[model samples]
Target: MQDGLLYKLAALDSEFEQIHRLNYETFVEEIPQHGENPERRLVDKFHGENTYIVCLDGEELAGMLAVRDKRPFSLDQKLPGLDSYLPRSRSLCELRLLCVKKERRYRKVLLGLFTKLAAYCEEKKYDLAIISANVAQGKLYRNLGFIPFGPEVGSDGARYQPMYLTPESYYGMKERTKLLSRMDGEASVSQKHMNLLPGPVDVSADTERAMAGTPVSHRTEEFNEDLARVKQILSSITGAKHTAVLMGSGTLANDAVAAQLSLTEGNGLILSNGEFGERLIDHARRWGLSFCTIEKQWGGRFSREETEKALDKNPGASWLWAVHSETSTGVLNDAGMLGEICADRGIDLCLDCISSLGTVPLDLARVYMATGVSGKGLRSYPGLSFVFYNHEIASRPDKLPRYLDLGLYAESAGTPFTLSSNLLSALKASISNFSAEERYAELRKRSDWLREKLSDAGYDIVAEKGQESPAVITIPLPERLVSRVLGMKLERSGYYINWRSVYLLERNCVQIALMGECREDSLSPLIGLLRDEMKSRHRA
Candidate 1:
């Protein structure tokens, strides 16, 4: 079961039941380690604490293993002098219940187990691993870099050897045709922790290396060339005639848009269907602009007819503001529809497309102005923001703050103050040759797959179906389970999902945003944790 088998962390009740059955099959019927029971299920005493990574052949369990970092391992009881036998490790984890089905014959099953084990160790930062290897397969264990560290333990008929594995010894294995090294080569070494944060997300190794050298002066030609390149890539992605790379958050970009809007005379209509939409309203209000609003529930979406009606009521509304992707609620308002509506009416359109820019293909060549950030969707370091506009602006040196003045940024060649060359270099690396079309399809594919899996596993997604953003999925936790508690629990298990923030806490919601460097191997394992959580709540 090479490609047919699935190797991932054990998270669901069904998987756990199968695991227990396999435990009975391996430990009781095969090894005689435990007495047989009528239930035909042998639960490991450490089931409460052990983190199980399994190999599955469709619904059936092909093989399984578990890791527990807690002290006083089973080996400690079996061998009195276990501590002296083990080498010093910065952090240690005990691997147990490594049983492969007889049909698997140890090779493929063990290979898959070790592959999953590698990812698990990478996540938990476990440098050294210890296992009680069955003496019958001692040669295979030794081949995989397990060194016998203590005397044999267990009954003569069912003996075991205490062994340890370290990265150095594992790599030093002369035989290198194993699955662990082959399947996950560079990914395992670099991206040990899977980051699921909405923003300040993980950057690629190349992106990090782009920022490694000494910072160049912003005034220098080299730094200015990088500035021009990033701006060109952003313009290509959004189709904006001009883009200003500002040094701040997405809010700063929006603030600059507000300053631009302050010059317009007529009333504008702000759209609000989520938290970010409300923030847009705040941006308008703080700028002292007179604006009407079309407000909806946080996760609700705006239809074209409703938007048209709002514009109709606010007769002579000169501009319209809306958020393309609502990060807080995982709702994506239709920017195209809104843009079309505004275009026909001659209403200038301003958008907060921060979370949508790199995740989806956006056409904004005809739009008035929009905001984006380097970190969230672009997968770069966070210190930079961009404001994209199609129209030219008059410099408002007297009316607007220097940073908020879009005209100043454009007129001064997108550099009014000193900017971090490191940030710009990383940003350029991330966005250069921007492939928004391909990224859009991939992001949607993964989001659809993940959403279906989560839905089938008894999780309640916050955004209504067909209205949710493919880049982020907001899940409302059950009334009994606090998002903070559940989110932190997953974090301890090596998944850093989004929760604990004020907005998420207020709504009892957690988000899984597939922003940067997401892959099938990393995303699929997350479902087990989610399913496990659902099963636990039901049991309670």
Candidate 2:
């Protein structure tokens, strides 16, 4: 058996036939059955119409099952005993023909399959699951928390138990299955099919414990002290003396910086290399700030000479805006170099470091103003952004708008304003995990490890080594596979990595960020899977 098995709804035609063959092998040949011609059964009425899932052990078939509305089975005259137990008015889903090969039985393939079925029932708002439990497998169903409520009956000369499971009981079983799946190394394998994939890194026990307390009032003095402490810690980590947390997203921080810093007599010089950089320009335009752009390709980086020339051309510019890390293309711009140039030219440097601050080394001493999010590199929940600036910018007595006023945040010491105490607690807990130097070292080590693993797997890293940010590693994909298809494949392998945008599809790039608790040991198996997938595609 393969180390991994992914389950997905089987499509029509060839894939459907493959699932039927696997079911025949498991249910008819290996398991005890009374149905005739079970070995060569061809599903006709219910084969292509209903929802069915196929389990794959790498590129090979493993098992399958079908689910359909329970009404048809409930109306059957031949199965009156089973029909009586099923609710007539309430909607129910029936599980049918669940099968697994003999070799894969010990791996709990049946349990995982049933767990998925239960989750599906709950998601589809089904009231109950009505099934005719096989006589030989009655004990297994009972162990799975299925209760036999109706009278026993004999079918096809074989005894069977009528069992049903409620939605609540089904979810209770799902929770237990999730716990067992984690222990059995199947949680990671099953995560590929989920929509919002959970990261491999588990939150620290200390952080979890810290977040267990009750929420506090953001307007209170105690909350003010807590907010100040968090800001001081963030400042120490990023080498910024003045950091103010806002009540909105990172975009608000970016807009705040654009609003305040574009006060110069001339147009702002906006650098466009990726999505975030382009967004800065958009913010500037919306605010009606005079601006000019020094545009580059998505993955392209600006050399010191090119930057100097751009600055020289826009000599009247008072502010230069850029993104430290472009999340869209997984590109990290040279903030330090850009900061120095802006300072030299008497231009205030405003940076969008939303995705870079926690994972990448940053110094606010060089940067005039910057924006960061509580999520992303900070590893906290979303809904807050921080704008860090020098005292000179904060002290500007321009009578700024109440919401965009940096002075209000500074006066309150990042509290007394409208803020979410729960998110603030989460941020404080997330930041307390490591010291500044420790976080920098960890980010660099993890990024380098992932890059080395992908490189050893015969894949090309999108960003050049040494110049890339420690937050994410982007890979240039093979020509044959599109980003969407590759994303679906990797998702099935239980690793949820980001793909480059549609605009960068021509570049054939895929990105993996080091945000989760993925270990070095797991990388080998993941690489092996990628290799096998690519090889199979070539053969096809």
User: How do the residues 68-113 of candidate 2 rate in per-residue lDDT, one tens digit apiece?
Assistant: 8835662254366555666553777766677777677764566656
Off by over 4 Å in 1: 1-8, 38-40, 53-64, 69-95, 100-197, 201-215, 263-267, 285-292, 303-318, 340-347, 435-438, 441-454, 458-460, 479-496, 517-540
Candidate 2: TM-score? 0.74
Poorly placed runs, candidate 2 (over 4 Å): 1-25, 28-117, 124-132, 138-212, 394-399, 413-416, 449-462, 473-511, 521-540
How does each model score on TM-score? 0.77, 0.74
Q: Extract clashing residue pairs from model 1.
A: none
Report residue 389 deviation for candidate 2 (angstroms). 2.0
Each prediction's whole-model lDDT (CA): 0.85, 0.69
Q: What is the C-alpha RMSD of each candidate to the true structure, in Å?
A: 4.9, 6.3
lDDT of 1 by residue, 82-155 (tens): 87887788889999998888888657677767866876786778889999999999999988888998789999
